[model samples]
Target: MGEARYSRQIPLIGEEGQERLGRSSVAVVGLGGIGSPLSLLVAAAGVGRIRLVDWDLVELSNLNRQILYTSRDLMRPKPFVAAERISLLNPRVEVEVVHEPLVPGNADSIVEGVDLVLDALDSLEARLALGDACQRAGAPHTYAAVQGLFGLVTLIVPGETPCLRCILPERPREEPAFTVGPVPALVASVSASEAIRILSGRGPSLAGRMLVVDLSSPSFEFIELSGECPHRPPEPPPRPAYFRRGDRLYAFEADPSGWERLERRGWAVVEESDAYVRLSGPGSVAVFYSDGGALLVGSRGEGDFREAVGGDLEDL
Candidate 1:
């Protein structure tokens, strides 16, 4: 509730870091094995708000490893039950429950404002969709998976660390796998710790690497990872001058000095580097290149471009 609630950890991470947790928000998608403990740990660490996303109901089978539920909570919505347990543990953390799976339709909105989204999902397809959304929105994602006595955890920082699709281009079979309570418990602990580290301004431990845990052999392995992210919105037919390619919806022919022109109008330059210059305004995260091309990734970004140019977007 106050400094006293986090006093023990404050000495370890300092008051500034503790306050950082209180100001940050995170979403834990999936309320099963890993999500249960991970969400609790984050809340106990004083994370300000947590969004619980899962579409499953409590089942007796899930009680074996899902620490958040018991026989009494059977058949209840996982998110709502998780929220109640979270409230009992720490009333200060605001909890929001979503009774839906993460898919392309809702992925973008799910990642909108959260500082981080931790993946406890058991579905590979959903994981990829979430990864795509997080990468596009520039949000941090922590991924964890458990099978049998083994599991892995990694932190994906958009534009930095490789996205999930980059690491796994092909979806693996979704065959049933075996898992024990200890395996998921350990993995979720690490997953929560990683989330806390990022929220508290200490950054992530698995930024460019993946931690592979095998409780069977009592081995903790760190595997290095490097790859270019290949997730991008699908291209559609160009509407006159606007073209879609890779991660950008852009205008092929633009004024190299157009940023200044837009700046004179209203757009503000947010980032500039050797590759391109970025502009921020009402409806786009746009970038301009030396070759007079404008890259936009937002929904109405093309409209913004058309208005800024003071003309219709026509063929180059």
Candidate 2:
């Protein structure tokens, strides 16, 4: 390859960094709004290999945000079109197309051998599944989503940072949402930058923090999350101590000071009884028992109690 191809970025990241990027592999798990521009940028950055995964054919309406697909691409499978376009952008990069939706059964295979995973999914459930798959594969993933003019991006480094399940424990079960053109492209650029930084070790990554963008208010917010994730193994359970309610999980804690500890960490005591002391927070609920048993519950569609507590409690 010619130095002129990377003449601009090399000054900032150095030739060594450019070469490092050439040796890395990444997976872009979606080919719509965010995924489209994200895949293009990832290839243009000179990443050695990229796996493009998406099952849907490009629809005419997607043209507004999915820049990788043109009017001619309508009715074409996204992965194939994306692979073709990305290949043309950087023939030096190997582009692999997976014309399938990412389900739990196939997510691991998609993430396997990839140095990074770029999650550009709109569905919260698919993002959750991809997060779990990355956890299982021990791959770092940059997750971003856009809904209308608002979007968020975060980087998860398998065991080192919180996974999506930790960041958002409860699965959102809403109908498909709307998004504009520039919103996803902006978030996707951030996601691509995180991937480049991680691959080249050139800049700071958003491993444990979230970047929230609200174009409506024209504001950007960065939030640091408590470093906890489902990938960490849960400690052994105490007799009949773990259970679940709906999407929320419940667990009995034997520590008398557990409630106190939670209170110190911002959990508010909401209700109490000889048998139970219930505590509440923005996204979780906890119940303490006089018999040294406690129950922790997750908020529906918001957060997960099990991930917060580092427990294995799941829906019954």
Candidate 3:
């Protein structure tokens, strides 16, 4: 029965690949739409250890795409809920849940000891932070993003492939608002399949290339990023400072003293200016004074800021 569970994948991945999957570890950030399915697939494929992280509660809206959760899981923390389901699905696979968000401050630690990192987050800030951390840590990372009927997937092999920042240079001053439905299920399956392929060494990986899929148009596109582009020097001490004000945005060099506390509160810079700093909130954007740090009440447009932060600021 145990062997029967993965009998199908074994023939495809082979015994050697199965062993590799069993010996390898993967850290999945976010247990919603993408992360949930990604985590479950990795576990079902017999990954030795899986680290699941998310600081969100299950909601009725999540049932549409977050396959890891059920009606019984409503109001439960995502990581914990995912861990429980994974345990029931495959006891041989170990599942570690971190009931917290991934930020610059603890990204390395959370990602430490893992063979690969997968971005299943909804926000651009978290995705950027994870990409930066993976680059510095020299760990392989796969990024997947979805909006409406479209989804994009990319594989970053540390110094070899274009880092996330290489594609997106300027962090956005505001967050993008969009909706997901059964589309995430399809997106997650594609993302998880890519990860499995990379893990099993079955086919050419997506490294150095972006896979864009549009379910609406039902089309696929691949874009290769130039390798000659420069990358920002890695920060020695990953800071938790990111804020925005008006049209200006600022990211601070984290101060060790209070950085952890700040990250726990999800205090990230959404935008910054000489006059004010913008912070992210639950589906809202808040701005603050740069000097006095007083709150600035207002609203702005939405989209992944990291997509804007790295390569060229001109388009933004």
Write one digit per residue (lDDT tens) for candidate 1, span 1-316. Answer: 2367887898878888988998999999998998898888998999999999975557687988999998987645577789989999999899987655566667787777889999998878778878888877889898899998999999999888888887787878886657989988898999988887888888788998999998878999999988766667442222233444223345444666666766676778876755456676666555555555554444554556567555554421
Model 2 regions more than 4 Å off: 230-316
- Order of all candidates by lDDT, from best down to worst? 1, 2, 3
lDDT for each residue of candidate 3 in 203-290, tens digit (9 for 90 to 100): 5368789888888778989988667546753563643444333443232332222222333556566544443344554444333332
Every candidate's lDDT? 0.77, 0.75, 0.68
Candidate 1's C-alpha runs over 4 A off are 233-316
Residue 288 miss distance in model 3 (angstroms): 30
Evaluate model 3: give its lDDT: 0.68
Clashes (N, CA, C under 3 Å) per candidate: 1, 2, 30
lDDT of 1: 0.77
Model 2, residue 125: distance off in Å is 2.1
**How do the residues 122-238 of candidate 2 rate in per-residue lDDT, one tens digit apiece?**
777667778877887788888898888899998888778877777876766675658789999999999988888888876556878899999998999999976556455223222
- The candidate scoring highest on lDDT is 1
What TM-score does model 3 achieve against the real structure? 0.72
